[model samples]
Target: MNSERDALTEILAWRRHGDPNISAVEAPVVKMVVFAVGDTLFAFPGASVTEILPMTTIYWVPGCPSSLEGVINVRGDVTSVIRLGDLLGVEHVTEDGRTAILLGHGNAMCSGLRVDRVLDVLDVLEERIQPPLSTLPERFQPWATGMFAYQGRSVLALDLGRLFQDYRAGLA
Candidate 1:
């Protein structure tokens, strides 16, 4: 069994470094704005994110969705912070509060998102996106536009607009 495992590892290493004919040309890197919701990591197209603000107390509004945590003052401007997990109906992200991700969707209205932490900016390519499987949880399906293999893990690419637009429309 040990020998078989060693052989498999050797073959994989060879395929990664020695297979010149099977080179997968690297994709043009685009910035990925990363954030954490609970322990899971996620990202949006960096261009879509305008700013990340520290966790601050919010002013609650009546008759809003449970996912809409509340509004925070961003440099004198009030912006609502959406609880990312609540919007997706993710139970693990049941923690009630987080920092704000002030996002502007291509000149559309700007809003804030409550996230656990903001990870570093990463660069990935369009070709790196893999289709989301139908087997994903129903709650997660609407938000996960696609998945990307970054480093050794599969990172879900979020559809920020899906979460943002409907809420903004409500305010209009």
Candidate 2:
């Protein structure tokens, strides 16, 4: 048993490739939180998201745009909520109890994004994320990052920074 313990390092070295230039570092991966806004799927970088909260009572704000779903009280902090479908022109479906609020902070602002459901939290190889296609819808093209497929669904990765910037500037 002592001899076998001493041979562990040698066994590891034996598994290495002959090429010294190639290190054994694992592939880079990007963690994402995937969610749906209506039937359209979207994702946000995990680093940008602070927390996830269940759908709660939203206090309506008068004179705001339709996309602004009002605000919610989270741990005594007032967080404004937005509907991605209203901003993107995606169809809105009736809430079916799986809805959630993703608390995300972008470059310019922080808000709660109302999503239909949080489908998954994934760590995907960076290479698996593909650039947005030229045929992407005009509304999404502006705010989207690369996209990737997960579990038979095509999920569009969005840049929360840009979206927040635009939202602050009254673009959304």
Candidate 3:
């Protein structure tokens, strides 16, 4: 089996049209970096992300869910940021050290999810995706639309709409 680095290299090459064997028949699989909240891996689609910035000042909103880290002013837009780990019921996103992903969720819903770090961006065929795992908790299961194998790793494809809905409901 190829090492993770090797797989990434090959995938990158394939994306750059370096390999003739792999033909992207459909709209090229969008690239994304998969991150972890404990053992669970979550993907942030590259297209939705506006920027990944180092931890910055966040105004805390009292009475908010523990998953909510705080609100940030990103590029003049005040965006509500949620700790990716906390929302998943995993580790707490550290305030002093972490990465904040500014995501643009269309229609002015959820603006972004703060994560620990970006793992890697890989191209995954949409056709190869399978429905979310049946073993996941029923309530949280809908947050992920499906999973796809990328560079020998299973990358969860998050449904932004479902995540937005869940978070919005949590606020109410």
Candidate 4:
């Protein structure tokens, strides 16, 4: 009975004062802005996404490439919108209530990425991100950095740097 009491007292004391030698290790988490282009889902680093704008009038530029959806006025700023589906060769989704513009800024430029819909904004553990699937589309493979699951659906994380770089080259 005494030994049992002593063990119980020790456990209570340990609970009151956790071991100082045990250092807490926090898992690295990446905040992401997830959106859908057609039936596929994609995400960008939250830090790169400056804003999420609602679907609005896009003033088309006559000479711009097909990937260039058009431009929109945000407050007083005019931001160019890139149709991700056109660039990545995904099935095109017409502009509708679910569409959104993710305003992302890269090293050299900033543009609004038009997506079919905005699915989620979430923090995903770094370890949760796995290498992209081999079956990924060729155009999409170049921009996909990693893949992770969100709400039972796999979401691909895109490399904003490479995407912007390619977009710049396409314009030239």
Candidate 5:
């Protein structure tokens, strides 16, 4: 029974002193959902995205803001749809095989952002993200928080809160 007790003590000692080779310091990562508006790639913080839905018929609401595409009936809940491409000054291409990214929740500024396609969800390291490029158009620069190189492609990280604020202010 002494041998068994010694083995248990050794196991406890190993557990207390974990492998020294494995560094505990990890770079901070930002979780985001990357999507395409045209050829341009944009990323939204993952927490802001509620759901992604396939393209559906959008009923136009007369007298609404030009940026707003229309309303969509999502599971019996009528959600307003925003033509993100239009707001971004991107050409209004035909909405073939588009996707809607539902944003916000109850009592928040809930709406759906229509995009050409959903690219991916990524955990990008914080250090890799740089400030929004000055070369971007003035209208688009304010909404873009940062930019990062992902898989050889430069992805712009959007600030949804600022975008929505500007949208409501009739800037978009």
Candidate 6:
């Protein structure tokens, strides 16, 4: 009984301070919110997503790019809504997109990405992500950071920073 007690104490001490011999290398993981746009599944890092809102009334902005669906009043803050399908060159399967994922990229540059549906949050190992598939349109390659399989489907991870930058450049 004393031997077992001693072993327990040793285990507790080891837990408090991890073993030095064990390589500390840990797999990189990112929390992402996966959503559907058209028939394709896409993901954005959770840190970039400020909020998820239901479809709301959007005030149209004349002369805005086709990708810009309109402006929405989010808690008195008017934010531009981007039609992700238009940007991805995919036909929106849903006539009325059901959700908007509010995304932010520093300096208060934020917008709501209209999506067909809001899926779930997933913790994805960075190594599991593969390069964008060759079959994807060339234009989409730049925005696709990587791809990974989730629940038997391929989810393309988007680089929100680059995407927003591209959008801003297009305005120039």
Whole-model lDDT values for every prediction: 0.72, 0.88, 0.68, 0.87, 0.80, 0.82
Per-residue alpha-carbon lDDT of candidate 1 for residues 1-172, written as tens digits (9 for 90 to 100): 4555587787898876886667677668778877777766678888888887777878899998877778888788887777776766644343445544655464366678777777678887777778887887776776678888766666787777765765566621
Output candidate 4 Cα RMSD. Answer: 6.1
Q: How many backbone clashes does candidate 5 have?
A: 0
Better of 5 and 6 by TM-score: 5
RMSD, candidate 5, Å: 5.1
Query: What is the clash count of model 1?
Result: 0
Candidate 6 or 2, higher lDDT: 2
TM-score of each: 0.71, 0.84, 0.71, 0.82, 0.80, 0.78
- Candidate 1 runs further than 4 Å off: 1-26, 92-107, 168-172
Ranking the candidates on TM-score from highest down gives 2, 4, 5, 6, 1, 3
Candidate 3's residue-wise lDDT over 16-92, tens digit each? 77579656455656666676555556776766566666677888999977677678887787988877766666674
Task: Please give, for residues 30-143, the per-residue lDDT of candidate 6 as tens digits.
Answer: 998998888889988888888888888888989988789888888888888898888888777675556555555633478888888888988998889898888987868988
Candidate 4, residues 1-172: lDDT per residue as tens digits?
4555587787787788866778767899999999888888899999889999888899999998988988999999998999888887887686558888899998768999888988889999999999999998777788899999988999999988789898888831
The C-alpha RMSD of each candidate to the native structure, in angstroms, is: 9.3, 4.3, 8.5, 6.1, 5.1, 4.5
Sort the candidates on lDDT, descending order: 2, 4, 6, 5, 1, 3
TM-score result, candidate 3: 0.71
Give model 3's clash tally. Answer: 0
TM-score-best of 3 and 5? 5
Identify the superior model by TM-score, candidate 3 or candidate 4: 4
Alpha-carbon deviation at 151 in model 4, angstroms? 1.2
TM-score of 2: 0.84
**Better structure of 1 and 6 per TM-score:** 6
Candidate 4 segments exceeding 4 Å error: 1-25
| Clashes (N, CA, C under 3 Å) per candidate | 0, 0, 0, 0, 0, 0
Per-residue alpha-carbon lDDT of candidate 2 for residues 7-123, written as tens digits (9 for 90 to 100): 657667767644466666789999999998888889999999999899899999999988898999999999899987787788767677898999999885799988888988989
CA deviation > 4 Å runs, candidate 3: 1-28, 93-98
